[model samples]
Target: KKRYKAQPIVLAIPRGGVVVGYQVAKELGCPLDIIVPRKIGAPHDPEYAIGAVAQDGSMVLDQKVVKSLGISSSYLEEAKKREIEEIERRMKMYRKNLSEPQIVGKTAIIVDDGIATGSTIKAAILSVKKKNPALLVVAVPVGAPDSIAAIKTLIYDIVVLATSYSFAAGGQFSQNLVQTSDQEVIGLLQKASGPQ
Candidate 1:
């Protein structure tokens, strides 16, 4: 958007979006910030997310799945507590006092590395909507078809580079599907913050 002089602020979902968002911010010549959300996984299926917690202590859960799995409200509460603690800690480590960018009258774009179930992304969209931004865009390089379908109504705009109607998972399309480190994330964020 630099060609059009779009002075936008980028909010990246951490752990994965840090890397993906760094590229977008660098290209847009905008300031980069982070929005860390933790997936509250159900018991015995810790990788399966039942809900998500945002950095500001706001949370959203899949009530249907929660009920179907017989997961207790107290169980989710405990998970949310731990997730919020991490959010607070990450905010201090990431931005200190950056004033949580004002999205009410600005173009606020949310970025993520990939989407599988899209639960966390949906929660992120919902969390940002509360701030009443002038525009809300969900940008991702990759995502599962079903997850993307589930969230089609949650955002004002969606930008995706690659799409497959029969996607099995987010990583199946990637060749270098490996985990990224926190130090790498910090470095990328720092690089993107520069107006190069």
Candidate 2:
């Protein structure tokens, strides 16, 4: 509150992030939006993310993991293409007629339920950086200590409520890890927008 005099916009990484972001935006009386970044999972294990692609086609990849896994360029390209398509679909579904949030002179808080590998959130941060917000802050309820430290190198301003050494996944820290639906995201955005 002391850092920012004007209202800061909260950009959540859906679908779980939206739920967390909604509460944050509501409490702060700020606008809530979504930054859709699809994870590029490993070929063998789809749940294991090797990289992520943001809405603007920008990506963040674990080069070591990509190379060590012998992920071919063709496979990466295919995966990126599919993820981009999904990103487009999600943007259309979530934003609908809403214009992109103007964050040039405002603080942009990128909220997420938690950070595991930090690939997807990194992509989201990169995508938001293009818009040139006055300040970019990464806020999450919980995160891996190493992952949080990695993100700290990119942006110094970040807030993580808890850090776990045994962090297996984000869901482990949360009481409710249910999958958030697209409809729920839309409703939250609408509610945050407040009758617009």
Candidate 3:
């Protein structure tokens, strides 16, 4: 983001995004901060993402998917409650005692490992927007073609390394992708900020 090279801000969607964000922030010489949002999965399809919730009780639903799946309002509401609880739990664990970043009037870049449904990134962008950033740029190493395309309309700018329209799982692009542990995320955050 040389356009704002004198100063820039990097926000990484945590868990998966942390790794990608680490590299981006390191390259940009900006401090890294995580925006953790839990995906509210479809009933009986936990791996599939239908929506997501931010730490501050912000939630976004996938109306098209919900309608296609015929999920009831109650079911959606219940899912939101569960995800909000998770948001709270994670906020307390990962964010306690840590002051949140100030994005107002600053160029911000949100990073993630990849965009699958774009729900999580949407949530992250919406949450960041509330902070009134001067500009918001999204960066991801790899993402599905549709997902990458869909996300560009939501943010001011987006940088995606691979938009191979072939369509496959996010991990398919990686040589050795493994489930990341919570311990690893905590370690990365601690390392980013000295002694906090």
lDDT string, candidate 3, 1-196, tens digits:
5777335678887677888887788787787788877788889897787788776657778889989999898987788788778777776676556677778888889988888778888888888889888888999888887888788887788988877665354667764887666677667766777642
Candidate 2 weakest lDDT stretch, 10 residues = 168-177
Backbone clashes, each candidate: 0, 0, 0
lDDT of each: 0.77, 0.88, 0.78
Give the winner by lDDT: 2
List model 2 lDDT by residue over 1-196, tens digit each.
Answer: 5677655999999888999999988888788988999999999999888999997888999999999999998999899999999998988999888888898878899999899889999999899999888888999999999999999887739999999987766767765656889899998988888753
lDDT of 2 at 98: 84
Candidate 3, overall lDDT?
0.78
- What is candidate 1's lDDT per residue for 74-191, written digit by digit as tens? 8888888988898888767776435566777667788998887777787788778888877778889987777777777777678888777655446666658677777777777666
Indicate the residue-level lDDT of 56 in model 1: 61
Which residue pairs show collisions in model 2?
none
Tell me each candidate's RMSD, in Å, in order.
2.5, 1.6, 2.3
Over all chains combined, what TM-score does candidate 2 have? 0.94
